[model samples]
Target: MISTKRVFTSSPFMMLICGSLILALALGFRQSFGIFLKPMSLDLGYSRETFAFALALQNLVWGITQPFTGWLADKYGASKALLIGALAYMLGLFFMAKSTTPLGLMLSAGVLIGIGLGGSSFAVVFGALGRAFDPSKRSLVLGIAGAGASFGMFAMLPYGQFLLNSMGWFGALIVLSITCILMFPLSLGLKEKKIPLKEKRDTRAALTEAFHHRDFWLLGLGFSVCGFQVVFILTHFAAFIQDHNLPLTIAANALAIIGFSNMLGSCLAGYLGGKYPKPYLLSLIFFLRAIVITIFIFCPISQTSVYIFSAAIGLIWLGTVPLTNGVLASVFGVQYLSTLSGIVFVMHQMGSFTGGWLGGMLFDRTGSYQIIWITAIFLSILAALCYLPIQEKPLNVLKATMQPIDKA
Candidate 1:
């Protein structure tokens, strides 16, 4: 018989490996959806806006379900939640393969896959990693796990395009379904952490308290911008490149560049989060994004410009995940991390919803993505400003109440 203690207290390296594998599988399948948009629209005679709406719905649904999924992951543990998520994700892909109408696509891609992603993506996996490691090493481990998503995008996005070219969109969906299902076996390696039956605080109260905290709101708002930037790029960057009269391979290569650079970005962010103030680092990232986007938009459109822009943006891509979660742990503590982080992620998803759909809608209406790019640049500036004023002190209700008295 295997030892339960050993499972619960596995080495950080072992935990990182398991978490990374799960993240790579979940994110790999999720990233491939972007590659399907144009092909699916052409085959089904759907407009870009129609597909955009479905992807938007997927983001919204994912956002709405994240809090609940995180709550479940916190209460029951990540293993079972991940398993169920994998099953749902696979089914969604299968159903997406059969979709002939926009409604069917919405149901499969938007609702089903959204819920699946909510339960299995970074939120759940990072929460598990957070629990398994000590505070000192948590950010590094989380960073490593977060890179799995970037690696997924690097590997799977091109692979998805290849699959589409080889087998067409329908066959690609079937293949993706098989790939998503593989997450199940990897999830089995994740052991559930034991929670005491009666805790000092219940999940509901924790969420309630987190909501009332001003800092949580700031974090949520800041995170929303991250979501908007990432989702907009992920959903439309390839198409945007194609619109510039560039080859599809150029678009694909740009995405791959982002993924490649993001690997280093995530690792560096993790190391920095361990030593510096996470919020300040986040502020710097947002500020730099604004500058980068502004420069890219104004610069002449060329293959070289695309590569430079992609590499710059990719470096900051998922770097937000580590700092965001690290801040949550720093302020709120790990006891309620999954739930609290879920709530923050809901805001992120809301931004994602807007970013994905709005980019498509604006393009359809104006025949240009320039406006959306400008909006992203503006929001990045705003996010940087917002982070500048945030106080990164720990959450201590008693200490907060005693502050004036202590000062007196």
Candidate 2:
């Protein structure tokens, strides 16, 4: 039996707390980005696609750089990666406030913010936490960290709205930039001593092996749906609310509710993943997402239906993170979890790029979000089907190769 007291006192627990805080601040601000869309685009006289493209670029760059950032965290230390991430994130937000042209927005919000996200977000945080806990506790700990992020979403959305109302987008961004600086102090808790060069060789081998593995591709493909659906909602739901002639507060409240429900869902997923098959849980999640989305789209748009949909969908929102991480850690071990997870995340970000960009493009052309909504549903079902066949058992090659390293 696991001792609760021992788990609480361990050094890793401190690391987990700090890492969770980092995600909360980073992702919390990210969740509120849609708030800037109408205001920023209207003020700058840019089309929605232009703004969306910048955000899409952000996701693309984040995906492209994740492997390198993950490698940085795995090889150097999470502290170092997070420190760089904090600085980049601060600068990104600061410059984002000063930007006027499309090029400026793309450079600041797109490129710089992407670099910041690659350094500070889920992959780096999870890799560190995965290495800290044994397998039995990894999912649970990750769930706890995930809940922290959710809380940030829940809390920060309203705060972001307040800032937007009082200080304007520029001032809100400046304040948020200042908030990012807090991450530097938190990075200290996740400090890890550098690993030896031999382990770097092993990481390359693991990367090669993962490339050869069929399940790895499937995981990446399935995860892409998550990125697509979530990013679409986060980026465009405000506009969707406006199109329907609903009050903006409804959208804000819905997003906040999603964040709150996600806390419960993430924790539940972690607990369930430990006891049941992670792949099956993943399948069920996607299926439920499809069902919820289907119902929400078919029903008349109203405050009641929107809130209900938000609560229902929110329960499964970021739950995938822990379950997916659990599957990778279970199969490959944590020897180079960051590097491997980062590669898979590229697929997710690709989906994110499509969802963010395609939603705006199609909306601008068609004047309704119906096509994208249907696409999201289709992608969710496809993801459900994809996860069903994944073999979650540890790889034999990994067992043979990583066992010696574990002993040392």
The models' CA-based lDDT, in order, is 0.83, 0.88
Q: After superposition, how far is residue 50 of candidate 2 from its true place, in Å?
A: 0.7
Which pairs in model 1 have colliding backbones? Answer: none
Backbone clash numbers for all candidates listed: 0, 0
Across residues 1-408, which tens digit of lDDT does each residue of candidate 2 receive?
Answer: 111111112398798889889999888888888879999999999899999999988999989888898988877778888988889889999999999999999999899999999999988999989988988899899888998889889999999988998999999999999989899999988887642333334666888677777688889999999999999999998889877988888888889999999999999999999899999999999999999999999999998988999899999999999999899999987867888889999999999999999999999999999999999999999999999988788888544544232222
Tens-digit lDDT track for model 1 on 1-408?
A: 111211254565776787787777777777667767787898899888888888888888888888888778777777777888888889988999999998999999999999888888877878778877899999888888888878988888888889888999999888988888678877766666673434466676667667666667778898999989888888888888888999878888888888889988999899998998898999999999999999999998899999999899888889999999998887777766877888899999999999999998999999999999999999998998888766666778523742222212
What local lDDT score does residue 202 receive in model 2, on the 0 to 100 scale?
Answer: 60
Residue 115 C-alpha lDDT in model 1: 87
Residue 99 of model 1 has an lDDT of 93
Sequence-dependent TM-score of model 1: 0.94
Candidate 1, residue 180: CA error in Å?
A: 1.2
Please state the error at residue 179 of candidate 1 in Å: 0.9
